[model samples]
Target: MKTADCDILILPGLAGSEEDHWQARWASRLPTARIVVQDDWHAPEPEAWRRRIAEAVAAARRPVILIAHSLGVVAAVEAAPDFPPDVVRGALLVALPDVEEAPDLPDSVRAFAPLPRDPLPFPSLLVASRTDPHCAYARAEDFAYAWGAQIVDAGDSGHINVASGHGPWPEGLMRLAGFLKTL
Candidate 1:
């Protein structure tokens, strides 16, 4: 589906996507896109995050497409089942953090552990980094397989965040456009 034909929901990870983050930049560029704000970015609550995503999808006037990063990927997938069926056309999941096994994640992030393995209800693509400090590449592969999402390997891209020098991330926009075409 064309971006103009759908509501693009941006879901940022812990601490939220900064102004220079790719998600924020994409939001500024995409007219139909908007960020789903959480109550607490520093300390996320799984149920709250899930409910917010579901509500965002439900409130959308057009078919939805999710663009989630890091821990937001976990929230989006966890809430996928709760979304209005058939309303969400697809999702672009990026930098999925290994909450279940990553050793350095904060205690707050671990609340989203035991990541949902059930296949997502809608078509989805997961963009994984080979050198993300938060998650192992192999584990990301496992997540994609479990979620029934097509995996895209991003070579040595550290977390694919602003800190990783992905401020504009035009490549990601191209990828999203390509994924949109498939839907």
Candidate 2:
């Protein structure tokens, strides 16, 4: 489906995508996009994050498409069943952190470690880098397979975050656009 035909929700990671983050830029560029605002970006709570997404999806007036990154990806998965499957068509899930051994993360994120590996009900894509500081490619592939999502190898994108020099994230936007076009 075309972007204008769908309500695209942009979900950001842990501390929420900063101003310079790619997700932010993408949201600004897309007329139909809106960010899933969490109560607290500094200290995330999985349940709260999940609830916000569920409510957004439930209230959407048009066909919904999720464009999510990092912890936002986790929130989306946890809240997926809460949304009417027919309403939200698909998702572009990106940068899954290695929940297995993420000790340095904040308490909010640490609580989500060893996340559920269940398959997603709707069509989706999982984008990961080969040398991401947050997760290894092998684990990412494993999660993608378990989640039943097609994996997109993003090379050494370094968690695909703002700190990694993805200010504009034009390339990532192109990839996301390509994925949206397919839907």
Candidate 3:
């Protein structure tokens, strides 16, 4: 199924994607896209995040396509088991933050130490940056392997957020569209 044929659910990272963030820009550009709201974008409760994502997937009318960034990527994995595989066609997982090693990491994130590594039941892509301060390239690849997702290199993009200057993120949107076409 084409990406345009599915319900695009964008999940932002810790602190949430700002108004001008790539995720926000994509939502405006895509006629049928919406953001999956976490209970608290700041506090970051794993179970709450998981439940919110699961609920969003459960309510989806069409095949669901997930676009997640930063800690939201982890939450997506946590919610994966509850998402009936038939409804969730694929995901664009990106910018995993190292909650384990972030010295100044919030208490909420550290609480999620020892992330899950089980392979995902659906087709997905894991996009990572070489210079992301939060996570190493090697670790991102490891996640891709464990989650059974195809890895995509995003060069030196910093967490792929607005802070890194990915305002419009036209390229990322095009790439997402390409992935959606394959679904």
| Candidate models: Cα lDDT each | 0.95, 0.86, 0.86
lDDT of 1 by residue, 48-90 (tens): 9999999999999999999999999999999988988799999
Q: Which candidate is the best by lDDT?
A: 1
Residue range 4-118, candidate 2, lDDT tens digits: 9999999998888888888898889899999999999888887888899999999999999999999898889889878986888889988888766654566668777667788
lDDT of 3 at 55: 91
- Supply the TM-score for candidate 2: 0.95
Runs of candidate 1 with Cα error greater than 4 angstroms are none
- The C-alpha TM-scores of every prediction are 0.99, 0.95, 0.95
Candidate that scores best on TM-score: 1
Summing lDDT over every window of 10 consecutive residues in candidate 3, give the lowest-scoring window: 97-106
Ten residues in sequence with the least summed lDDT for candidate 1: 76-85
Q: Clashing residue pairs, candidate 2?
A: 1-183
RMSD, every candidate, angstroms:
0.6, 1.3, 1.3
Q: lDDT tens string, model 3, 37-124?
A: 8767888888888888999999999989999988888888878999976988999998888777756678888777777789998999
Candidates 1 and 3 compared: the better one by lDDT is 1
Q: Which portions of model 3 miss their true places by more than 4 Å?
A: none
